[model samples]
Target: MVAMTAAVGARPARAAPSAARLRAWGRGAVGAVILVAIILQAGAAPFVRGLAAVSVPSVVAALLLTAAATAAAAWRWRILAGRLGLALTWPQAVSAYYRSQFLNTVLPGGVVGDVHRAVSHGRSVSQVAQASRAVVAERTAGQVVQIGLAVMVLVALGMSAYAPAVGIVLLAVVVACAGVVVAAAVSTRARDVVHRELDAVRTAFGTVGTVAKVVVASLVVVAGHVATFVVACLAVGVDAPPQRLAAVALIAVLAASIPFNIGGWGPREGAAAWAFTSAGLGAATGLAASTAFGVLAMIAVAPGAAVAAASAFHRRRATRAAAVEESS
Candidate 1:
């Protein structure tokens, strides 16, 4: 009876993790399906051509733009961290941000990088919770600003065929959020976390001029990404009007924000293909452009890989030195 009871109690615990694993696999599978569908629809020629089309000038431009964006993003993150009592210097934030970008580019789920950076930073500050919150707040703020800018771009020059659909989706989101707020008010656990997040956002934006500074930083990041995408499109010979191309590029960037992606591949490419097609550009052209953009993105973050290696080396060396000191 004792053994049976123990097994029965352990079943629920095991089931929870099993369910979580199942969901993760499901998400990955969806991402894979997206890529496979794109490949089936567009063929591999565009992708190969895209890789071939990358030139030295384009690579240099991408690197410079990426650096500028990384700096701005790091500044935004530092501002949020400062307000959260998890302050770190701008240089530290930039290195950590680069590390996160590299990891996100190479890893599945697209957010493993951010989580790693947050935990490591948290540990450094001896305030893991605050540091974690700062990261979350920073990411959340970036996404919000990006979406806001997307809406501005799209509305100003939208040839989008599904404007009504997008509006409906936004409306639905607002309603769902309201429902969540109501539900959280009645739920002890949900209320606490929701309130905590709300407080964190308020604190992060509380200071005079902080909001303007953050918005500027976010704009610089957005401009860099959009400009890089444009360069990719140009490299692939997409001859659409400047405004329309910018709109399509912004959409592609927003799609990259989707979490269910394989190293930031699936949604971005898929959306670009569709958006370009809608904009009267060939679907293959969009695929090629997005593919080129992805490659440039990887190249731009290559420094982060070096940073990760050096940081690991120093950490191991420090551990050994400490061991020796203790022994003596």
Candidate 2:
């Protein structure tokens, strides 16, 4: 029985890399190229110096806000899970989220964390698929919020003084995204498919209290991200206004979502620098803020180290117990 169980569990674990894996690898390569481009454009010395000179208070503030941001993320996940009928406690969701974030930073593709979350909940394949779709929806909502916030911040900061060319480019992106969303939503087949799955859809949407609560929480999450960036700015002595914080925050979030540069190191910093420069701020300041934020985030993730250790120990003990049982 034990041998059979082991066989069923193990199978032949050959590495069958899929098309998706190949694409992810390609994206990683593109990310590396982006890093090289940023390095060439920005010059290496100023970047390094900017990262090195961050102060203590900024670090503290960034860490605090980072924790809040992580909590907000867990809250979002909880809402999604509840919608899917797989309810997890806040503490459980938060711990698992932190571990997932750690994995995204340390492991390849980052999608593995999604798989981990799905399997950890002991969900069926269809449930996992629905849950994964909801995660993507949540992410889309956050990005929409980020873009809106960035635009508002730009207007508020009077960064409109920059070349009209940039504004045109931004307008084009907005139009393109709007068009894509509209096209998808307006398709009768698409609407029918979505309506057909109303049960799952309603369940997913119902997890959170109301749309207003979700919106409010999303705002708080965005605010937390901006606060973290502002703290990083203070640490690095950037002296920018609260409005400018949105640029850095938006860029950081967008770049980090792209799978590359071990925990978002290269792209995050580079994109931040570009965002700052476009906002009429020095690239050094953006680089500094990005570096400080990254450092504080890594520190915030330290608890996940303990969680990982505990999980490993539990697995080992379970294995040993199974061995004893099999022998008996």
Candidate 3:
């Protein structure tokens, strides 16, 4: 009996790590499948061709747009953090956001950078939960606003004219979101978290001035992203109308937000292919455009590399100083 109890007690310690490994494996598998599907459907030609089309001008535009978007995103984070009673400055938010974006672009699973950002920020504040919530709230706001803008664009362009399926997809998404809300309401733990987060969101963005600022910032970020996509499309000789391209760009952006991706690949390419094809353009054009956009996006986040390097250097210096003090 004593042996059995000891074995049972030890099981949890081993099980936790095993479960985490399984989850990581599952995510990797999903990402691989997504990449395989894109290659199978679109082939590797478009990616290679798009790379050759990248120009110095396009690279410059991407860098500029990325800076604007990052600044807007950081501002939004600052607003939310302040509302949550966390100490955050614009400069800190901007630097952290850049580092996070760089990490997101280079790391697998697409969200590792966000996870790091939340944990690091939380640790600094000594209110880990609140800090994490702030990140969540900021990202959630951006997504909601992005979706809203997409819907408005689709509606304005008349969904039936460009793509009837988009309207159906939007409806399905709304229903799914409603279902999730209902499910959360029925579950005790989920309901508590939902209510708590909702309260936090309200507190952070409740005021008229704050809400306006957040919405405007979100719009700017979305516009910058869409513009970059447009630039990428132009670079690849995609001659679609600006309005049509904007709509498709929004769809691709929304798709890129899917977490089942390898370093921000997968769904983005898949969605771009689908969106462009549905808009009466060839799938290859979509793939090429998306590929260019991906490259440009990476270029835009290059500043993050410097930020990361500086951070590492500072840490090393601090460690060395601490060692010297200890020895003395």
Best by lDDT: 1
Across 1-328, the per-residue lDDT of candidate 1 in tens digits comes to 1111112212343343344334434555677789888999889998998898799999999999999999999999999899888869977899999998997788765766776676678768876667767777777667678888877767777555635434643675587679768878899977876787679779989976888889889899989999999999888888878998888898788788776677778988988887887888878888999999999989988888987888899899999999999999
Write model 3 residue lDDT over 1-328, tens digit each, in one string.
Answer: 1111112212343343344334434555677698788888768999987898799999999999999999999999999899899998787899999998887777555655665566567767876667767777787778778878887888888755545435545675588669659968789876776677679778888899998988999999999999999999999999877888998898888777666666677878888888898889888988999889988998899888898899889889989999999999
**lDDT of each candidate versus the true structure:** 0.78, 0.61, 0.77
Q: Give every collision pair in model 1.
A: none
Separately for all candidates shown, the number of backbone clashes (residues 3 or more apart, or on different chains) is 0, 0, 0
Position 323, candidate 2: lDDT: 100
- Tens-digit per-residue lDDT, 36-104, candidate 2: 787787677756665675557666666677678778877877776666666678887778777766755
- Pairs with steric clashes in candidate 3: none
Q: After superposition on all CA atoms, how large is the RMSD of candidate 2? A: 7.2
For model 2, the stretches where C-alpha displacement exceeds 4 angstroms are 1-24, 54-56, 108-110, 122-127, 156-199, 206-209, 259-261
Instruction: Name the 10 consecutive residues with the lowest summed lDDT in model 2.
Output: 1-10
Better model by TM-score: candidate 1 vs candidate 3: 1
Candidate 1 Cα outliers beyond 4 Å, as residue runs: 1-26, 162-183, 322-328
- Which of 1 and 2 is ahead in lDDT? 1
Give candidate 1's whole-model lDDT: 0.78
lDDT of 1 at 227: 95
Candidate 2 yields a Cα-based lDDT of 0.61
TM for every model, in the order presented, reads 0.87, 0.75, 0.86
